[model samples]
Target: MKKSTRILCNGALATAVIAGLSAFASGYLTGAAPWPASGLTALATANGPVAGAPSVRKTLLGSAPAQARFDRIIVRYQDAAQTRSRPASVLGAVNAAATRAGLTGSRALAGHGASVLDVQHVRRLATGADVLRLSRGLDRGETDRLLAELRADPAVKYAQPDYLKQRLDFVPDDPRFDLQWHYTHPSAGIDAPAAWDTSHGDGVVVAVLDTGYLDHADLNANIVAGYDFIHDPDVGGDGDGRDADAHDPGDWVGGNPSSFHGTHVAGTVAALTNNGVGVAGVAFAAKVQPVRVLGHGGGYTSDIADAIVWASGGHVDGVPDNADPAEVINLSLGGSGSCSQDPVTQEAIDGAVARGVTVVVAAGNDNADAGFFSPASCKGVITVGASGIDGARSWFSNYGATVAVTAPGGNATSGSDPDDRWIWSLGNAGTQAPLPSPEGDRLMGMIGTSMASPHVAGVVALMQAAATEAGRPPLTPAQVKALLRGTVKPFTVVPPASKPQGPGIVDAAAAVHAATQEIPVDQGELLSNRVAIAGQTGAAGDARLFKIVVPAGMRSLNLRSYGGSGDVSIYIAYERVATPTLFDRKSAKPGTGEAVVITQPAAGTYYLSVVGESAFSGVSVLGVYQ
Candidate 1:
C-alpha cells in the first residue's frame, strides 16, 4: 500500500493524539518554540490543529469556498544563460514549444503584447526569466498535463500552474482619527502625524502580505491591482484559486470572523488621511500592493515565499511579473524557528533586499524572545517589537537581541473597555466572533507585533519618500535600518529587563528629518610616519578604499575597525583596486569590529578596503597601523 499524507485538522486523529499527550506531560507547552502552549491552544480553538491544518475558520461573512478560476501555466526556457535583452527570441521559443505541446492558438508576444496562446500578459522577471499567462482556463489535471508537455520540450525550462496568492492594514482619518493613539502619542506612538508634514510616502509602493482584503470605502482608492497567490481552493476561500483579483473573501476559521488583518495593516501604512472620516495613516500617500498569502486555516510558508518574490518583482513559476514592484514589503506573519535555519524564507528576504526592497517583519506575539521566530530573526530584515501607552514594551510583544526597533502595538493589559489604551485602526464592524452589524466601517483596537510592524513600515515609506524628494537615491535596507536605530527614542524601562529591547521607539519625524539630511562619505588620510584614519560604511555592499604606503622599514601591517552601529569587514590588497576582490588579507567577523594582521608586508602601494555586511550600514570604522 502507498503511504499518503493528509492535512491535519483540529478534529483529526493527530490533534486528538497531541491533545491527549499534553495531559501526560507538564512541559509539553514549554516545548513550543515561537508560540507558547496557550498560543497554540488559542490557535487550535480559533481554527483547528496547530500543525499542518488547513484553515477551517470562517470570517465575519462566513462565505463558502469559491471554485477555482483561470487555468494558466508559467513556462521558462531551458537555456540557463538567457539574458533579458532577447525578449523576442524567448517569446518565439515559448510560442514554438507551446505549438508542439498542442497548446493550440498559442503565440508569444513581448512586453504585454497580445498572443494567440491567450497570453494575458508576459512579465520579464529580475532573474531574466519570463512568466506567461494562458488565456484559456483549465482544470488542475489539464493544467498539469500542459505543464508536463511544456517541460518535455527541449527549449522549455520548467512549467507549472499559475498559483494564486491571497491578499493580506492602518490609520487614516474620516472621523475617529484621534482614536489612533499609536500615531500621535508622544512616547507611545511613532509620531506619524507630525512626520506627515515632511513626507507622506508619495510615489512609494508597499506590498502587504496577508489575507486578501475587502472592498472598503476608505482603502479602495489607494489599492492597486494585486494578484492572489492562494493555490488551494479550500484555503483560498475566495471561491476561486489564484487570479488577478486580490479581493479578500473571508478568512474566518473555526468560529472566528474575518480578521481583516491585511486591511488593518494597509490602513496603518497608507490609508487616506485628513478625510475627516476614519483615522490618520502613517504614510497617507503611499500605495499598497495586496499580495494575499494567508487565507482559511492560515497560509503555507511556500505561498508566503512566492508572494515575497513576486511582490519584489522577482519571478514565480506561473505568476506574471509585478508591474508595480514595492519599495518596501511588510510581513506581519511568522512561524516558529530561526530564519537562519529556514532557507526558503531567508532566500526570499535576501532576494528582496538585494533588489533594494526594505523588508519589515513583526516579532511574534508569544511575549517571548523574538530570536526563536522566523523572518523576524532573518538577517537583512527590520524586525519590530511592540510598545504600549505607558512608553514601555507591550506585555505580549516579543523581546530579544534580534529586535531592531519598537513601535506602538498597543496594550489592553489596562483593559480593552477603554479604546484609548489600544492601537486603533479601520476595521469592519464585525467582531472577532463575526456578528451581524448594521455599521460598515469602524475603528477597531488590537494589540500585537502585527499592529506594531505597520507603524515602522509606514515610517519607512515616509523616509523613502523624503529621500527621493531630496533628489537622493533610494535608501538601501541597511541604511534604512541604521537610520531607524539612530533616530529611536530610548526606552524608559526595558520591557523584559532580562533580554535587551530594540534601540528605542521608532520616531517617524526624526527618521524623516534624518532622511532629508545629506550623508557625507569620509576619505581617510595618511600621516607622515604611520597611516591612521577614521571612516564609515554608508550602506551594504559599500566599499571604502584608501591608499597607504608601507614605510621603508615596516615589516608587518596591522589593520582594525571599531565602534560602529553595524557589522564591517576589512580587506587589504597590494594594488589600487576599485573593488575589494583582489584582497591579500581580510577580516570579516560577525560584529561591529574587525582586524587583519599581515606578517611579511612587502608594500609598494597597499589599498585598505572596508565593506559593509548584510544590511550593515552607517557604521564608523577606525583604522590604526603600527
Candidate 2:
C-alpha cells in the first residue's frame, strides 16, 4: 500500500457534525482520517485506509427518478398447498378485496355506461404464488389502502407494492483493460482470465457496502437501485442524509478531496467489460448493489451494521424491504476493534450469513494482526489480506489466523515499480493533481486489503454463477470459504515472520472449478499414480473410503497418513467385500505421520479407508504406486 506523505486535520468539519449530528457522528472523526502509522516499516506509514483518500473534489452528477410509481402489488396465498390446488380461489379473493377497498372502476358496454372493478393482469412468480399489476397509475396512499384491504383476507399470505426494479446495463467500451495486470498476471494476480472461460457471473448480485458510488460511464449500467444509510448530512455530503439516492457527492476533507473509494471498489467487482472503452471487471455480468454506509470523513459502525441487514434482505425500521437482495456482500471498510467485543457488527454478519449471503471483508491495512479488527475477526466472514505483484504480503495488510485468503492489493513500497505493482481501477480525475470541480472519470491505482477483498467477492460471484448454471444448490458461506481456502495456490515464497496468509493467494479458477464440479458419489475415489486427499470426519464412527486399482504387473503400493489436531487411523484391505479390521494392514498412528508399504503381490482393486478415532478429527492420506 502507498502512503501519502501529507496528512491534515479537518477540525472545522468534525466540529460542524459534532454540533448538529451527534448521533450519526459518534465514535468517529469528521474528516477523512488515515490509519495510524505502525512500527512494522517506514513505508508502512505511507499508506492510509484504502477509502476516502485525499483528492480534489469532482462534481459528477446523476439524474434522479422522475416520479414515484405505485401501480402493482405482489400477492401470495397463506396456504401454498391450497393455492396450488385451487388457483381460482385466490384470484376471486383478490378481486373481492379490491372491490371492498373502493378501487372498482369499469368501462361502458353496448353504448350503455356501467361501472366494473379494475383487473388489469395477473402473473405468477417463478417460485411464489402470484403478482397483480393494477391499472397504470396509482398513488402511494391508494396502493397502501388496497394492500391493507387485501391483507384483511384470511387467505392472503403477503401483499405489498410490486416495486420497480431497474436494470443498469454494464457494458463498457473502455480501452484500458489490457493494462490490468492483476487479472492475468501469473505470479502477482488471481488468474481471472482463466476463470472467465468457465463463468462470467450472470445471475448473481453482489452488494458493495462502502462510501457509496459515483455515476461513471464505465460503471452506471451495471448498478442496481441501492440506499444511503449515512444519517448525517455532514458525513453524507448530499445536503440530506439516508435517502434513496446512493450517488456519492464527495468525501473531501482538508487534505484529501475524496478517494471515490466506493466507485473504485465497485469497478473491481463488476465494472463494464468488453464494451470497447474501459478496464474489464472480475465478474463482468454480475450486478452491483451500492449500499452507502461511509461518507464525508468516515462512517459509523451502527449505520454500517444496518446496511448489512438491509442488503441481505432483512428488514430495518424506516427502510423499505430490498427488492433485489444480494447473494454476496462486500465490505471494504473496518475499524480498530475485536469482533468478540463488537456484538453489533458480529450479529449483523451472523444474520447475513444465516440468510445465505456470503460476506467478504478486508483484513485492514494497519500492518498488524487482524484479530484486533471488528468485521475481519468476525467468525463467519471470509477475511482477506493483501498481496503484491511479487505475491508477497502487502506492506500495509493486516494478518493473523483469522485471514481466510489473500488477493492482489498492489504494493507501493519504496523502489517498487508502479507499472508492475499498482492496482488500477475507475476513479475521478479530481483525485489527481490540481483539485478541480465536476470530477471526470479516470483510472487510478491504489493498494490495500480494501483492494484485495473485492477480488474475492468477484470470484465468489463467478462461483455462484457457475453453480447456478450447473443446476446445483448455491454454496453456503462456510462452503464458499472452504472452497477458497482449499483451492488457493501455494505462495511461491513464504511470507515474512511466518504470517498466516490463509492457504495462499486466492485462486479464482480453482474456486469456480470446485463449485461447478459434479457432486461426488459417497464412495468415489480418485485415481492416479500418486493420490493425496485431505478431509475431516463429521461425527464418531464416521469413515471415508477410497478405491485404488492395482494393475496385474504393479510393483508395490505405498501409503502414508497424517492427522490434524485429532486421532485418525488408516486401514488397507485387499479383499473385495470384507471390512478391514486391525488384523489387516492397519496403521493407527498416534498423531500426524504414519506410513505403511505393501509388497508387489496382488493385482486387483484394493480399498483404503480412514476412520476417525474420535469425532471431528482432520486427516490426510497419500497413496503411491511404484
Best by TM-score: 1
lDDT of 2: 0.64
Q: Can you give the TM-score per candidate against the true fold?
A: 0.65, 0.58
Off by over 4 Å in 2: 1-178, 414-416, 431-439, 519-626
Number of the top candidate by lDDT?
2
CA lDDT scores, all candidates in order: 0.62, 0.64
RMSD of each: 14.6, 17.6
- Model 2: what TM-score? 0.58
lDDT of 2 at 251: 59
**For candidate 1, lDDT tens digit of each residue in 1-626?**
00110111001212111110010001100111111111111122222334653322111101112214334444445455355226576556555555655555433233225334545435543333355656655544445555666667665555544333222111111111125667666777776756877898999999988776666655777888788987668878877887888866756554334566787788788777655445557787899998887776556555676788999888876678899999999998776555543445666777998899999998766667676667677777888888887888877677776788999886654221354555666566443322222234544545567788899999999999999999998898877987998899877666654555677899998999999888654333442334345445333344566766675566567666667466667787775542455677788888767877776677556666777553343454443445
Where is model 1 more than 4 Å wrong at Cα?
Answer: 1-178, 414-417, 431-439, 523-553, 559-595, 600-624
